[model samples]
Target: MKHTPYYLNKPDNILPKGLTNSVFRSSDPLAYHQSLKNYTVTPLLKLNELAKYFGVKKIFVKDESYRFGLNAFKGLGASFAISKILEKDPDIETFCSATDGNHGRAVAWSAKLFGKKSRIFVPKDTTRARILAIENEGAVVEKVDADYDETCEFAKEMSRKNGWQLVQDTASAHYAEIPAYIMAGYFTHFMELEDSIHTLPKPKIDIVFLQAGVGSWPAAAAWYYLNRYGVNRPKIVLVEPIEAAGILASFKKGKRTKPEGNFKTIMAGLNCGIPSLTAWDILKDSTDAAMAIEDSFTKQAIRELYYPTGDDKRIISGESGAGGLAGFIALMTDPRFRNLKEALNITAESRVLFYSTEGDTDPENFKNIIRKKK
Candidate 1:
């Protein structure tokens, strides 16, 4: 894919000076963590037992489960993105998006933060609690067809016709600038991740398994950490749900990957069928690997984090957010991946990091299954 310049990289950068100072601090072309102070970069907890089981030196999870009241790292992205966009184009009277849950809520809430009217379109299968949660954030909520792609189509079509500023959570060439800004917002989380890494005991980013939703966050993260740390940078592993492995499949396809598909995944954030051109361009030229996991594995991984045996301080982790660790665990348990671990040199000495991207937007639904496990 030929490189079309990012908004941040453009010669006449249209971002206002105030917005640039407030959000666009990072050197990474598509990210900034200037607003990361309010949100906690949840710790990279050492999973000694899991490490031993996988025959690795160390394993850690960058629990994004502690971000603001929302309990997801996504807020960092949407909030920062919306702010800069608003600062640059304050004339935007309305903002809108299509999300499985997280991105829409974050973008809508951030829009409200800037006193803009916002709306979120979701798939029909989305939970009642999710709809209400986004609505409570001062967004008008609408439900479309069952699939995520359908919701995205609805949101885009509506935004175009109604003259609302469309904040498509996924990326596309037609309107790639916003997604680039979104990726820059996501960088703040990774920037926080870089800081948190230094505080960890014997922190060495030999491997990083990151979740993907059109791959914006991880691509921006890869750009930052790899450049900051140099060629010995961590080998990045892109994690997506099995049904939504299009990003990975697309990566291996080089420039030949199709831009359209009918993909499904239990990980709502990973439910995207179309590739974000912004993310695809970045990830294609930079990432180390792309992988996918089953929904059953996602369930177990969530339990491992939130229901740590005998520990009652329940960690608030969203279902889809835990999918990165799930994919990591799958790699650990895989016969084919055993030797690839050697490629990463992930021995007892190697350190790993994975981002927990969202909190349980629907606690009752999360608890419905979780309560039984208890």
Candidate 2:
């Protein structure tokens, strides 16, 4: 049952025009993130041994496991979105959202931080550890008997009925505002890199591999890099699970598309079928290529990160968090992706970047995966 990877390169090299909006350039993200308790810049690790193994000059990984001790990067978006809403309406008491895992925990954490109540809904397959994590954040957690998309709808309906503010990252017709704020909040990490990258041996990044669930995180990264570097921006690659490659399917259709599948993957956070409209708008023009990887590849990536080569640092990456790296590894090792490697111009001299978006959020599953021998 080995599923081969897929890649689609855009014909045009146009920069993302939509990213030029003032919200991306605003100073609010940095200010808001700094105001939070225990706000510190996450580590940017240089994996030289891994670079050498892959015949690359440098491989820089932004480890977000240390983010607020949440072991994931979703807090950046959830915290900022809630703060923005509170600034406008301080009287709001309850916030609600649906998630596969990380985002819901982040939303619950943010609500607790703001002294507000939260109601979170998750798909039926969500792990017990994830549910407990959200509950620990002081949120009422419910497991909806549906997929991620259907759970989102169920949460929306309940939010409407109970008068709770929906803080979802996926944007619909009239729901673009909060999603926009959430995406803008991701600017804080890239902004930190803008300053710290100057100190690296290879400051100019040749490419970036960003993992997408509903595409919001990767879209934010794509928008930030394309806007910051203008014409000389690094090549952006969007990666997702083969079973839930919504962004890749949308890229092929020249419009927002919902991929047709069961959307089941060990990468729980990335088990999404539909792309957010806001994410699609920017990604459709900004990203260089879209790639999909099998869940097995992500398992391999997780093991690789956990067991480092030579003097490289160990990164505790979850299934979804290892997705971007999984795509890169597949392209390099699998002869099936030779054309994709060449199309992206990855070479011995290329300096690549990746974000380890989460740690081992599910401890038992992580242990079992790492213990398995292929």
Candidate 3:
């Protein structure tokens, strides 16, 4: 199945009016996150050379590679969700979740920190490096033969049977509270980025290209920017792997939906088949556009980041981390996506922002890809 890059524009009034009154605005999560040990704001870097290449006014990449020493942004949500769960059940004995890699490790790390047992479930094809990372944190790792969504269901059942709290980020109507905590936890990243942008002299980020999996992260980002900037909020572009474009498919159908078939992609972290219901509610009306791109484009993006042009700083963005940049570059360079570029009002005056959500999470595969390039 050859997948082509695709984009869709959202309706003008898709979002609700006055997002400032949203439930997430009641308390500031940043203060709690900042008080944690070793919590430092991740770097928001200016990619001058890339900006010039794309003919954009400015481009900023929030590098989540060093976030909480987890080499991914998952920790921000995992740690906070676990803390909130523990606050309610101080005597909770076990925690559990499912993931392709990063999120499960985060759950394990948080569980270890809180002095509780953890059980992490991953798809059978999950990389050894990620499994080792999870196990290293004292969590029992289980590899299931099914895909990510199936693994998530299996993990949910396991948690229920054992009376363990499930910390999965994707939410259903019946299971929304924990995922809401996880999404709220992601506010730490946006809060820091907002502060960093505010400090800039121009502070003119016009658009954001957000990579989506189960849609929690992007929804969190959309919530923050919409509330903070209101009508002036940056345009949000949701990017995903074509093989697992659940959010994009949902957007096309005008409702929440799941992608069919086995969701396989090199960008493991973004290979989620189902969209979180909680995230869908926030993103459905808030996002400006949604896009799905081929896997090869993401590989090209990884190489570009690894061996940057001109004086651009070299970044070690993993397969999943590079998707947003890949989507952005596609819109700028591919003639077929010219309509998308124009619709989003991407011009030389447009300042753009995106995230490198992880570093070399799978070190062996990273080494192989980088070495193959030579």
Candidate 4:
């Protein structure tokens, strides 16, 4: 996450009407199925101990774990994006997506709620547990041999051939609309985070570390803060797996960059080599910086979640859900991050807001890793 001098053309000013309101409170992910739906996103308890350990201001993880059966913030993007796409021309047959894992699950659950059939295509090596989770939701899963990008192309081709509505998130003119809808669903995330921060004792959120897949959720959340609060907005940091740092690299290079290598990261949700165009557009204007973390660092973050000294069982979160905290820890551990750390003054007073996006979305897999600690 280098922030060298670079220039970007002025960004777009297209704010969706879905974000203008602040009454987010949907208990059912299906009920609030839009870009930004029902949820008073609340500020979870900040670990004063962890804050001091990190030598940064207060660190409060904004909990998105309370969404419909699905826990991660992807609920916001996937549900809303898919709904918007369908609303224009509701497809009764099938909704399709390519994913490392989470996004596909989200779309499957969403399609089920809307009384639609769904199909998910995942890389051949995708864990049976993750794919099974989607199947448990009643959506059919197709396994493809190859990488994430390849699966995505297969999903598109299959959708075209089968007349299914392809709910692809990586942006394009037609697909860009879905990202916009996805971002709209995330407005509640910002609304709830702000509400939670305001409720804190010393409630100034200095920084917000967010993980990016298609980049819509975090980008839209930060954009809402910038538009409504201006200088009051928290410093936004975008995180991704190092192997799939395509968007971050593109932003850093002042031109869009897409990687050809197979994305091999444990943080599946953050493993996209190409990002949503709409999501990218907003991040270009709103983000303060970006960072990437190795899969090893994400594993270390899993340790932090489980090792809550003195028997407080930390909530078992999916690996993808831990991406932001992983990147933050990665940044702190890096020698290059030393100077950036000093410059950012990321101390306990910082009131940093992060997200634990999902819970044990894949239980057996999560248990396998957790059991190893014993």
lDDT of 4 by residue, 1-374 (tens): 23421122233444333322221222223345433334444337566666766778666665566676676666666777666667678745788888877778888888887789899999876888888878987789989997777788889899999988877667655555555565666665655544546433333778777888767667667666766666556677777777777667778667666743357776777777667666666677677677777777667767777665543336555777777787778767877556656666676566676788887776776776677562
Better of 1 and 3 by lDDT: 3
Clashing residue pairs found in predicted model 3: 14-285
**Can you write out model 2's per-residue Cα lDDT over 254-320, one digit (the tens) per residue?**
7788876568789998898689988888888788888787788899989888888889999999988
State every prediction's TM-score relative to the real structure. Answer: 0.83, 0.95, 0.93, 0.84
User: How displaced is residue 364 in candidate 4, in Å?
Assistant: 3.7
- Backbone atom clashes (below 3 Å) for every candidate: 7, 0, 1, 17
Report the number of the highest-TM-score candidate.
2
C-alpha lDDT of candidate 4 relative to the true structure:
0.68
Evaluate model 3: give its TM-score. 0.93
Score residue 150 of candidate 2 by CA lDDT. Answer: 97
List model 3 lDDT by residue over 103-216, tens digit each. 999999889888899999999889899899899989999999998889999999999999998999998878887887888888888878656684333346888899999999
Error of 3 at 248 (Å): 0.9
Kindly list the per-residue Cα lDDT of model 1 for residues 205-277, writing each as its tens digit: 6778878766777766765554465455667777777666667667555552543334545577777665676
Candidate 1 TM-score versus the reference: 0.83
